[model samples]
Target: MSVNSESVAKKIKELPHIFVILFCVIVLSAIATYIIPAGQYTRVMDEGIKRMVIDPTSFRYIPNTPVGPFAMFVAIELGLIEAANITFLIFAAFSCLYLMEKTGAVDASIALMVNKTKKNPKFSIGLIVVLMIILAVWGSTGTLSYEEIIAFAPIFVALSIALGYDAITGVAISVVPVGIGFASATVNPFTIGVAQTIAELPVFSGLGYRCAVLVVMTTFTIVYVMRYASMVKKDPSKSLVSGIDYSDFTIDDARMSTPFTFQRKLSMLTLFVGVCVMGYGLIFLKWYINQVAAIFMIVSVIVGIINRWSANRIANTLCEGLSKGVLAALIVGVARGILVVITQGNILDTIIHSCVGVLQHLSLHVSAIGMLVFQNLLNFLIPSGSGQAAVSMPIMTPIADLIHMNRQIAVLIFQFGDGFSNLLWPTSFMVIVCAMVRIPLSRYYRWIIPFYAICFLLQAAFILGAVAINYGPF
Candidate 1:
């Protein structure tokens, strides 16, 4: 073990922890603000989209708005402020989770699921596919944001391990479907909704084609995950985290026989009712995190009462859950800081403008592909779906028109670009979810590389097919 050999070996195995990785990207992004020239486009309000949209013809070179080194430090606080809704909801959701866990409801549910998986393994496999589809529906049609999956990640991971599979299998069933759904967004308000409205196409007008895409991608993802799960189950050594302890997740006959008591059932019902109320408000009242957070607070109190917990006991349990999630939630804010730096420097438009310059020279085929690749890269800088839409779509819409590409196809390209690398990118929810479930980003990346490669192939076919068929009525 000479010094050089040891260094080489260390390089082979060592990747920075997730926080260090995100912070390094942040510093680099802040530095980029000084290097990349700052520029701007006029943002006039559009009544239809109900937001300020870029005026493509109004692009102009502006004086640099570089964030100072001290300002870069300040942006972390600003980033948390900008991301307050998500950060607050993280606390609320975790509190509710802890409230449920204390009442024996959480273990009872897992115990029951394990019992069923033992009796009917094939049915359990089918259940994975079904679960992915359900999540995809929520992601595709509604405003399912990244960190929103926090409530379900642990449960699914525990369930997957209990079923003799691995942690990645749990993510495959839970997070991957949502990511794919976002990539193939059929009616997602954040991506399609904003993009379509900006393009002046009817909102959700191309539902039929998008739904077909959702089906194809969803099917492929299910097969990919199932194959992996089957392999890991048969040879436990193949599991990425095979050496990991899952003390809280594993169960035995005594645990399996844990009674489904009446109090536990009521606790579960109370939580379900809270979710139902949130859904109603989301669809009809157009609610977001603020509304969802309020509902969870109410639910936690009811859950405490239903289980006959003293007020102090309820408070303690709620705080316990909140403590478990601070790391995960702060990751979201730290990631948000990267976007804040980019925004503070006013370099976001400059980045988009520079890419558009390169794109303008390519042939129609290459231009379409370029847009997809560019969007994927840009997501590293701007992780907010609607925010990306607001910034990118106005520029892209005219690009579509100039090249005789359908606006719908342009929208699809943006959708694919914005979503496919979500979990792969350190700045996105992938880091948060991986942290929450105790999976290392490097290991998760190894597992996901193949999945992302196949996803790109699928994206290429769908984008090209849409071009061939002129995938639009408008």
Candidate 2:
């Protein structure tokens, strides 16, 4: 079915277990606060409820302060902000998709690319992998924005349709490769740059090692996704929505009537150049002049008007895109609320202290493993890799030093825990992207488990080997 033909809103509602999972998390977090006494588990339960309610900004600006019951409420508020960011980006991206659809640019682009790769699917896949590798390598220079997912998603969808693949397959092909790149990032400004800077490592100091890890992780992710996609293609009945004939969603009809005008082509070209320039500014120039969304929004408007799009049409498209974003933002916002509540109850600190305390008793070798597992568990609570790094790194680094563990190894542990679970985490942006494309979380989990298991083991083994040789930045 076409995106325009169906009520996307209704589809979102019909998805099973989504709300149940969300509600359960919130309720469980609340219960945790009640069960863990404030005195016993300061990290897990914040007794100082007054601080949180009295000042919401305190939680945003000041780290390590106990907020109590107010933590739940504040978490919800911050969760809203995070949601807003996602919403804004999604809306903007969707707007571009809608316009491209209406104008036929998307179809034309896909048809052109498909014809070139029609004879060899392997070549097409290789091309995608190569591009991801290039993007990952340049990502650290501050040139890559996670927002590329937004720009390329519809293209992936269109290409999959052209290639006689399921829509979910298209989403997977586009997202998983980029995800692998992001996860195994050699240069991702957001993930690696932010993380390494926080860890006090020289900028891009470990490029060679990270690049190697990136290749390993990317290869594993690609093989698994491709295999799962091929299975789904052969057996549509395997899908949750087996009755849906996604093949009818043609890129040709969408583009046939929309002539490729000079202005339209120019606008599209400008967007391409703009994104490249934005990447350069972010990495090499160290420019943070605008959030990636803002940059795209401004460029989109300028291009829209230049292509002679009517004012009303532009406004309508913008609104539609923004509405989708708002929905995503709400989910994120609510999730963040749970985090805030847990923080306020002072349970967060208690939990951290307790975990570290347990590690204190373990032998040095065992302590490293303990730290790895502990960081992974902590990932559920703090989803952002950079945010988690800021909070956990300082504390964990000192502990590593005491045990004669390499600080670099400690950081690697943090990266592994933070990056690997992103494929599975409901709270993660990648998961949100999958939801946007109508890929069921349950199905995604099934497709991804083998890949995740393999990568996790490989990463763990790599870390242990490094520790064994005392080859570390510490």
Candidate 3:
């Protein structure tokens, strides 16, 4: 093959679009039902929490209930139905953030921040660090979806560009910290909460250790991102997204020269306050998806009125935002669709049980590491952190007991496996961010691998330490 032809072939060999990947997984999961035996564990109420948990000693294989080819298509719709709440939450959150973006307040604020600190690279780095920590904390709540953050992509892209960095740096500024924070989840309701419940451990216990993990991961991500951002700013050609038509995400001269008006500041203030309030509601009010949706809607309306946007204009912007999220929402449903097939066919537990059984003979510390590996691999099939916890924790809890492993360590391993990979996995919410910013999935995978390696090492070390010290309350 000629050189040009070779380049073309290489391009063709790149990973398929996320939708295609998810669809193929859905089909394969449906087919696997026939091969993987159907089995379930009996559930019993935990005396302290009054939550039903799998009785570790009560698992038994049941008759296989394999899904047919036709049923595979049905699983897609069922997956959408199962994921409806999160889907709608994504739509609503995107719409609200879209409304704020349309007002140009957030963009203006980002531009202003960039301009004020552009002269001081360290100051600009500090800005990136602060934004990352905030986003990471929000992600740790386990309630913020990638869709909610998608609207901020353009703003950060513009900010990074203004700081003489590239679009990929902007994307990293927006997502990498959240991914790290997510991996080091302390009180994350989705992973920690669900896994603890299933494991019959006190919810959010063992957080001291998790906090330490979070600090290390967040600090490392900040350094990694700052180094890359500085390198790109020094030489734009070094940027991953160099030569891409990212002008759409860049702040033009006209936008930059424009003064940041008081109305814009207040509008930005409203956005911050809204997020703070939402965080409060999530942490204290015990809010879920619907509540998050409602809060975003309310905030959008308030910001709209503050921006003096007429009802008709606000309505149009909201619709446009919702449209932007359609791809992401569909992606969520399609990814969830694979889980639906595996779940409805009753093979999820079997898969977990079988994997855990393999770890039975390993040394306890190695078994804990094996559990982390299993959960990490399983996360590819089931990207939803809470869903994976629901499916795996029941079996893992018992395995922890059988192998003399601390249940809290098991939950910690689950948290690490379920979350750290979201940044790396193609079939995950990270794809939604990629879709929003037009970042190719493969490019993101390449950019994130080193950081992910560091995270994995940290997580393994933490898990091993947990095992050694018996990190637990149970």
Per-residue lDDT, model 1, residue 246, is 70
Using TM-score, give the best candidate's number.
Answer: 1
lDDT of 3 by residue, 1-474 (tens): 899998898688567888888888888888899999999878776554445656667778999999999889998998889889878988888888778777777667767777778666578877888889988877776656464566567667777787888777888888667777777777787678778877778888887888888888888888898898888878888887665687777777777765667877787788778877777887788777788778788888888888888999989999998987898888888788888888889998788778867988898978988988998989988786766776678778778888888889888888899888888776777787777777777777778888788888888998998887889873
- Weakest 10 consecutive residues of candidate 3 by summed lDDT: 45-54
Instruction: Give the per-residue lDDT digits (tens) of candidate 1, residues 312-350.
Output: 999999989999789878888888898889989989889
lDDT of 2 by residue, 1-474 (tens): 776657785566454655456657766777787665443321221132111111111222222444444555566677677556655666666666566555556566666666667767676667655655565455323345345564565567667766656666676666666555666666666555555565567655666767678777766656765675567667766654445545535566535345566776777786787677777666667655245666677766777777688988877777775655554445656766667667666577567766877987888778877887888788888886656765676567677778888777777777777767766666666556555555666666666776677877887887787688775542
Cα distance off (Å), candidate 1, residue 201: 0.4
TM-score, candidate number 3: 0.92
| Candidate 2 residue-wise lDDT at 24 | 70
Q: What value does the lDDT take at residue 325 in candidate 3?
A: 80
